[model samples]
Target: MSNFVTLLVEDDALQREVLADVLKDEGFEVLECTTGEAAELIIASTGTELQALITDHNLAGKMSGTELAHFARDRHPHLNIVIMSGTTVKPMPVGTAFLQKPFSPERLLDMVRE
Candidate 1:
């Protein structure tokens, strides 16, 4: 396994499982969660090990993915953050990437690899 830990936050069960499996297959150590709040806890505990964060924009908790992106970026400048959503996110966080819904796994992997 790779040391490049990635945190994936998605409320949808199937989406989270598939994405986590893909990342794992690509040799990334993926930490999966269903809500931004849970993701925040993971990031807080493993920020140093985390290389990337891929989160769905709208979550099932108080914090949204964009909010989580900002928080993670603020604490870990070297972290690569990607916000995925079916709709556009206005004024996306300065140092984060965006993936519109229905994007291919290849595209997502490319973003994370970059």
Candidate 2:
């Protein structure tokens, strides 16, 4: 199996695809989702294979990224979570990372590598 696995949850179709492409370019096995509900289901079923999660704060579904992050952290404590947002909201939990939107692909790659 590949050494890196990443899940990307973003509501914007273009952004999601762009991010997925970047991760793929870096040799990560990437799973993409546009909503928190779908993200939750994917994580539940594939948490063991997931090395990291990249999500946006706002999503198309009822649940937000923060909710998903908390759930994923509870279920998979060792997983790395990175939350992105255009506007600042609440502070993230310790050990979790944040990336502001309008970020360069290089910055995103750096964050994922970290």
Candidate 3:
């Protein structure tokens, strides 16, 4: 079976494109966004079938990735969330995943595929 649909939120254009392409190649239907606010909109309107969210912790907008993830989790309790950042994190919600920056595409895929 195909992997579930995923929303990828990253402020960096190149990183967003690369991750989207990699996820697509791995049989995941991918949606891309540039900001946490945009990602929240997608999560709200998506109305199911979106299984995962991969967000950069340091987003361009006022909403950080953790904020977006929390907002999403409230509505979609089962949605898998992955937050990527170079800085240390504290008190993330249960079941959310974290990845440090500069990870390879393969490493990213491994996390998502899990």
Candidate 4:
């Protein structure tokens, strides 16, 4: 089993659950949140367990996915990030992976693996 841990942040309940299941199926330890604030709190509380972050570009709270990715990158430079969006937004930071919305589970897994 891989030792990688992934933090998944998505506002949509169904989407979050589906992604979580997919990650789990791939043998990753998954932590999920519906908002950036919740994701931030999880990272703050358990920074050591975090190996990567996967977030939706649009969230239900004050902070956007890009903002969360930036924050996580600031706090943990080694953490890998994958940002998913259905709409075009500001360009993502260099080196951060982007997954367009409606992406297949296999594609998402590939992004995380990369």
lDDT of 3 by residue, 8-113 (tens): 9999999899889998988999989999999988899986798889999999999999999899899899888999999976778778899988899898988886
> In model 3, which runs have C-alpha deviations exceeding 4 angstroms?
1-3
RMSD of 3: 1.3
What local lDDT does model 2 show for residue 27?
A: 88
* Candidate 2 lDDT, 23-85, residue by residue in tens: 898889998999999999988887477989999999998999988999889888889899999
Q: Whole-model lDDT for model 4 versus the true structure?
A: 0.88
lDDT of 1 by residue, 1-114 (tens): 479999999999999999999999999999899988898888888747899999999999899999999989888888999999999997899889999999999999999988
Model 1 Cα displacement at 72 (Å)? 0.5
Tell me the whole-model lDDT of each prediction, alpha carbons only: 0.92, 0.89, 0.89, 0.88
TM-score of each: 0.96, 0.93, 0.93, 0.92
53-96 in candidate 4: lDDT tens per residue? 99999999899999988888888887889999998757786568
Q: Model 1: how far is 77 from its true place, Å?
A: 0.8
Q: Judged by TM-score, which candidate is best?
A: 1
Score candidate 1 by lDDT.
0.92
- Candidates ranked, most accurate by lDDT first: 1, 3, 2, 4
Which 10 residues in a row give candidate 3 its minimum summed lDDT? 87-96
Q: How many backbone overlaps does candidate 4 show?
A: 0
